[model samples]
Target: MLELTNVSSGYGETQVLYDLSVTAKAGRVLAVLGRNGAGKSTTLKTVMGLLPTRSGAISFDGATLPGKPYEVAKAGIGYVPETRDIFPSLTVRENLDLAAKRFEGSDWTIERVVELFPRLGERMSNGGTQLSGGEQQMLAIARALLMNPRLLILDEPTEGLAPVIVQQIHDKLMELKRGGLSMVLVEQNFGFATSLADDVAIVSKGQIVWTGSPAEIRADIEAQHRWLGV
Candidate 1:
């Protein structure tokens, strides 16, 4: 559903990605795992068009993703950046409403997202700033769901949260996976990423260094340590 071939991109003068290639199939999760400064987040940003691609190609659902963030989004990709990017002053309901898209034939509605995260229902009127970290994360994902995107891209969904909250987030993600949502997840938490991913790719210095199934990755401790420092 998503493919990047020899993609090279950077913030400005310093090039971060070099001939990076990766793929995420339809109705499956593809986790890009790496440690801090491994350029995992940069990969997502380039794919989402937040950073320009200097070389190579990126195609989603059989068409090229325009090199503009809004155009990429309008082309049916939902991105939840590591920053969470929630409007602090907007109410939970307001946030969802702001992201709701019908032009792409959305299958998700406010009711559906609220049902997926019941806590969101109770806090519909609460401002985004009022939510805890976990709650804020839920709100971010929930807003994306309302867009009914063809492919979901999430960066560090579980970062900086308590273990319990991480589990909660993981549970919801698994639920989404079961529902056949295509996702590209960039995460530093190897175990969490592998658990929900159908395929795994280890990224190092903005390039994919290893590609395998979760089981293969688990059995290769040396590869894990070398590429991921796990």
Candidate 2:
């Protein structure tokens, strides 16, 4: 559903990506694994058009994506950053209402998202800041789903949450996968990322050092240590 060919990007004067090519197919999760400062988040930002690619192509569903975030979103890719970004003053319902992007034939509705995440339904009237951190993360995911995106790109979805909440997010992601939603997950929790991913890519120094299946990553201890420093 998404493809990047030799895409290179960076902040002003400091490069963070180098010929990074990756693909996340429809109905599958592609986990990008790396240690701190390994450019995993940079790759996602480039794909989301938060950072412009210096060279190469990014395409979604066979069409070239313009290097603008709104254009990217209009093409059906949803991004949730490491920060649980939401309108702090808005109620849960109001936040969801603001993210509506219904194209003809889209299937994910706000009601369906609330059904998937019942906690969100329960807190419909609560202000964003009033919810717990985990609840806010849930709200972020729910808000993204409300866009009815074809591919969901998440950056460090389980970075700083309690284990129980991580498990909750994991279970919800699995359900979304079963329902045939494509996802690109940039994750730090190795076990959680591998367990849910069909394909794995290890990034280091702004480049992909390894690409394989989850089982292969688990089996090759040497590659694990070399690229991931784990």
Candidate 3:
């Protein structure tokens, strides 16, 4: 459903991606893994057009994603950055309403989002700043779901949350995976990545150093450590 070919990009003068190539199939999850500073987040940002690419191409659902963030979002891609981009003052309902504004097809709705994360329903009118960390995360996911994205790009969805909340988030990911939602997940947590990823790509120094199934990755622990410092 998505493909990146030798994508090289950077923030201004310093390049962060070096000829990185990766692919994500529909109804599957591609777990992007690496140690910090391995350019994993940069890969997602570039793909989402949050950062400009100096070379190569990014295509989603058979068309190119131009180097523009709004255009990319409008082209049926939803991005939940590592920061989880939630508005502190916006109510839960307000947040979902904002994301739903640009949606134009049959994929997601506020009701579906609330169902996916029932907690959001209970706090529909609560401001983002009033939510717990886990609730905030759910709000972020709900906001993205309301966008009706064909492909969801999540950067560290489970970062810094409690273990139960992490498990909850994982369950949501697995649910989405079963529903055939194509996803690209960047995670530093190996256990979390292996549990949900259909494919794994170990990135290193701005390039994909290994691409294989999770089982294949386990069989080559030495390489995993070398590339991902696992």
lDDT of each: 0.90, 0.89, 0.89
- For model 2, the superposed segments whose C-alpha errors exceed 4 Å read 101-105
- Residues 1-230, candidate 2: write the lDDT tens digits: 78888989999999999998888888899999998998999999998888989998998988898789888887888889899789999999989888864443357677888999999999999999899888998999988887788899999988788999999999999999998989999998999999999999999988888999999999999998888777
TM-scores, all models, native as reference: 0.97, 0.96, 0.97
For candidate 1, the 10 contiguous residues with the lowest summed lDDT are 97-106
lDDT of 1 by residue, 1-230 (tens): 89999999998899999999999999999999987888899999998888999999999888888999888878888999899999999999888888774433478888889899999999999998899999999999988887778899999999899999999999999999999899999988888998999999988898899999999999999998898888
State, as a TM-score between 0 and 1, how close model 1 is to the true structure: 0.97
Best candidate according to lDDT = 1
Rank by lDDT (best first): 1, 2, 3
Lowest summed lDDT over 10 consecutive residues: which window, candidate 2? 100-109
For the record, the alpha-carbon RMSD of candidate 1 to the native fold, in angstroms, is 1.2
lDDT of 3 by residue, 1-230 (tens): 88999999989999999999999998899999999999999999998888898999999888887779988887888889899889998998888888887674647888888889999999998998999989988988888877788888899988999999999999998999899899999998899998899999988899988889999988897987798776
* Clash total of candidate 2: 0
